[model samples]
Target: MKTFIAVLTIFLLSLQCDRFQFGSNQTKDDQAGAVVTFLQGNIFITTQGKESKAKIGDVIRPGDRIITKLGRVDLQTYRGEVIRIKDNSDVLFRDIAGASRQNTDIHLWTGNLLVKSVKLKSGQNLSVTSPTMVAGVRGTVFSFELEKGSVPKVKVYEGAVSVAFKTSPKLIELNEGLSKENYTRLVKTLEENEVVLEPGEKLEVNPNLNELVYLINAKVATGALTGDELSGFVDFENGLSKVNAIVSPQEKAEVETLVSIPGETIQKQIDSQNADNTDVTTQTIEKEHSEKRIEALNRIASEAEKTGLDNEEEIHSHYSVLETIHKANGEVLSGAVVAQLGDIFIVHSTKGVFQLSVDDIEYVEYRNFKVKTRAKR
Candidate 1:
């Protein structure tokens, strides 16, 4: 009887050891990415049927769903890519770290997200999947914005990106000077749908029509279009051939006046005057013109913001100069303000979306008004 009891105890001990080993392996397999940083409002993470509030220095495992409400979260993957998820956005970590053989895959459900990748080693990859399109990238800086009813928009900043539609087998390049004809051809061609995007190019993918539309409207907002192009594209009488019910004649005039004064030219004139000790009368006149130009720009920005606010459901339809960050070293960066996390301001410039440290910023110029940083309490 004693011998039989001892043998049964040994068997039970062996089973316990096996269970311990299995639990250790399960924990290792469930490991995911981590939250490197975050700022303002509520950021929640739901994983494995459990929901919890996320904070800085928290570990985010694979299969985790991150939801941001009135805040932003910056997450870093094992491969050293930083993803900044903006306010009112939902993203799922479909694959991260050891979850998949591939590098990383993120799914953006709604709102905007900016991705900045470190130089990748050979065979490393990062892909962002949206409702309509999938962007495969390597060592690139880019942004993805999505709305419920409209299509998804992707903009590249530094590196090139290849975007493909979920339904179509083709991919399209969004390189510089992609002509309207080539764009149309790609839309029509099924096999040659893939496009590479260069810096400063933005494209929107329409899943419903299986079409890609280059946002030429961006050129209008940035004052890059010539008078003829503007008149042709936006003028009610001869351009779009359709009347713009939203833009009043006075507003059109204001836009024209603001674009007429080149910001670069004004800066150059001011520099030259200061260097040559120009007459006070000439300097004063130039300064007055610059001030007036700034005022006009502010008015336009305000009107655009107000319009967007009034039509919140159609906010994506209105493109406006969101804000300008002036660096202490005299560099001016402009674009839509994606988010402000602590002392860092993320701005989507023509080059790409950049994170500007508040410590390095002299001030922010929005709608022609100068705003200095507030002192920390």
Candidate 2:
């Protein structure tokens, strides 16, 4: 079977490049790339359609729907957060939902997604619904996805949701297994064996777990950073620190460096570069300063990728062909695609999303979602 071969490989080159440390809640490794975690399910990937039972390292992509044999697909973020996609459903992953920021956001166009967001000062969030409606989070576990049927429906199995009413001053709380009438119209909040949620606690749901949704161990965890996944990894890392106090010294140092003016040498250089030139007024100076700050931030992230696994190995399997298959042997790109089961891979040279038949793309990566952010402190 000329299946999607997920050949994993890693080759770190030594250089006198400027290095930085991992920020709080961020991973120090880049191996994880954009993809945090994935598993084999009844997946379909293609321009329009495809079917296969993906193995260990198959890359998954947007427009791809994964149907688990019995349950659903559980995708964990670096912050130990989870998005459980139920069986027999479809959720269109819109974007990477940036990983390295204070909050990681994943937009699910349609399908069932059980989200266990890792808390941070600016915690992570996963939105799994149409544009009209969205799920907000402030560090907690929850689930939302469209249930299959003649008419697609939205379901939230855990946590409370500030369900926006179609037309009224009424915003109700949709708890676990509490059928939210806003979207699904399957409105039903199981009152039996149910405990009232504390303040800041959203709806409680047990779509698959049955009546008792509170005991499902919805506590989300954090993971290390790896590969180009530094950005998202950083987000998770920071989130962890804020929620609790789980941070490495290296990360602490880096965070400190970001908040301050940084090294004197670079400071002097930047100062001189913009000094005295009245033409470089406050506006210009601030602009240049901001750019440098962002550069410093990228440096911090890049250096962090150099760190170890706490940074898992999910996003380190993509490759950049050397233009020609015969010639481009082992010549990968700066970024890689970590393969999932139904990843519609469009190699740099290929025109469309080609079927990556690599059984085990040992080294694969999915790009992290980009966000508008300040470079550094």
Candidate 3:
């Protein structure tokens, strides 16, 4: 009984510092153009006084739904954000930040949400967190899952996110917008439209893929790929050696691939098999560059900064990576090689990167993953 009371007390107290406030007068009639569409599950649209409770496993899609948990609730204001609330999940909404940028705040008790948003602007983001995780978005679309665990997982579907509270600053990560499967479909559709893929191929959008794979696949599909581009992919094996010494041989191979992993995944394999690495230097550099894997990481971060939490963990966690390569001291790597560095991107042009460390770095520039500690608190 004591524990139950404590839990309830915490939820009640959350309203104190909560920032998302919905106005009662901004009802459906006030916002005549705002339309709510239930693409999948039954979603209830209510006003401030109308909504009070919601259960877990409940799905809300493409529509206006009055929430009732008491602090904040998020909406896909651009009408592009897709969100889902699981059973026993209670949420509350007060007001949207502004119409120009589409910043919305949401608070969830216990469940899940899948969100897809149109590109938003600065200060037009979302702030949400459970006991395990916290996410801040700028103007991207994605999904979030909260359950009882050591840490909750945040997944991005369309845009990018910066997620904190998982570990260190690197845990202040970048996530992607589309799933690998979706990316593949995107590629197929592009190919089909360009008369390149098999006839009748459709754009495939999967919710289960990590955003990185999705972006890569999408680039491969929509972005023009010439013989030289295909050759770059073929250069994988040789380029594979450059990052070897800094990362585990197995890890080096697994980390850079464009393979697709499904949604509902906990990234256990990626987590458990993180090379049992104790090389702090490699870990630091790796974590930093993870977001700088390429320019796209920056683009995602640039867009996410619009949300107040751009510096937070939830959004960018889904959209980043680092690419390091080594060549003979004098050999110049191709632009393609340099482009691989996404966030805190780096290239060890020094002799044998295998024998390098942060100390060896001539200089460093931290990008999407800032060196400062916004997470420790």
Candidate 4:
């Protein structure tokens, strides 16, 4: 009888393990949204205020939050779409195959995500929202990151993505009357809504742009400004404040006409002014360029700047194989290729950060690095 009891106990343990591995209430329909395919390190799923360690084959529905502390996790949605949540990330599934919704919404409170999305069926959408910006994609492979103390960025590898600031001006606030021509222009600006990023394009929304909107709104409330010129000010501020794209001295001089402070003062404020409050533009030539890259590229650039290009032979010895992307149309992009997610390559060039697909490129020369730390995502 002891031998029979031992076999029965082992069978019961197997059933209990299945019950714990996959959630107890999982159904076939639950797999339509988020189903964990792979997990490493400390991954947790919080549902209804309770947290449990995540396991492979666990189905996470709407209103669930995935928190990664020391590792990474891969979630599979319907149609084989994969979303990789990198380490030190916090993401929430706001809407995923809900009863009344056709879109799958992933809201990243903090950290990085690499998304490989499949073409949606009719009337379906996929959106990712960070604190500063929102990206709407129909079918695309993309990377969206919200790193601390840095601007939120979106890079599209394949297909297209429409991106816009969360604080973009709303049309409902245009209460004042205007000419038909002016009204048409204002509506057009607001309706454009977001920047449509094609394949090989990337965008970064400056955190300061939201502050400028607040300043504009305050001025409008005091009756110092009117509705007719609001769009121009917003468009101008958006264009200049974005990183990687340089803002000229002439444009900086013109901004004083729109706001109380000089454009230099605004830029100074964005940089959080040195303790001495001396003008940054006059001190560092690098600050004037308005060029921003991911930390990896910044590291390479900083080392090069410290050891002038005259010492190229010494510098090239430390680094092997600078990354260069050659497009099929004969255009060339050179930068530090930071991260590779499947066929998508995220390149940080002097011009800006670009996410390009292997399909769009004729060939690529890249380096393999041994580093102590990597850029988040």
| lDDT of all predictions | 0.53, 0.32, 0.32, 0.54
Error of 1 at 37 (Å): 2.0
Candidate 4 worst ten-residue window by lDDT: 252-261
| Per-residue C-alpha lDDT of model 4 across residues 247-273, encoded as one tens digit per residue | 322222112111111233223332332
Q: Taking the tens digit of each residue's C-alpha lDDT, what string does model 2 give over 50-86? A: 6665432233333344555543444433334445565
Reference-based TM-score of each model: 0.47, 0.31, 0.29, 0.48
For every candidate, C-alpha RMSD to the true structure in Å: 24.7, 24.2, 26.2, 24.8
For candidate 2, report its TM-score.
0.31
Among all windows of 10 consecutive residues in model 3, the one with the lowest summed lDDT is 235-244
Winner on lDDT between 3 and 4 is: 4
Backbone clash numbers for all candidates listed: 12, 84, 72, 0
Q: Where does model 2 exceed 4 Å of error? A: 1-41, 45-53, 59-71, 97-111, 148-160, 165-377
Superposition TM-score, candidate 4 onto the true structure: 0.48
Better of 1 and 2 by lDDT: 1
Q: In lDDT terms, how accurate is model 1?
A: 0.53
Compose the digit string of candidate 1's lDDT tens values, residues 117-175. Answer: 66766555677877556677777777778876667777766687777544311112112
lDDT of 2 at 51: 68
lDDT of 4: 0.54
Candidate with best lDDT: 4
- Ten residues in a row with the worst lDDT in model 1? 235-244
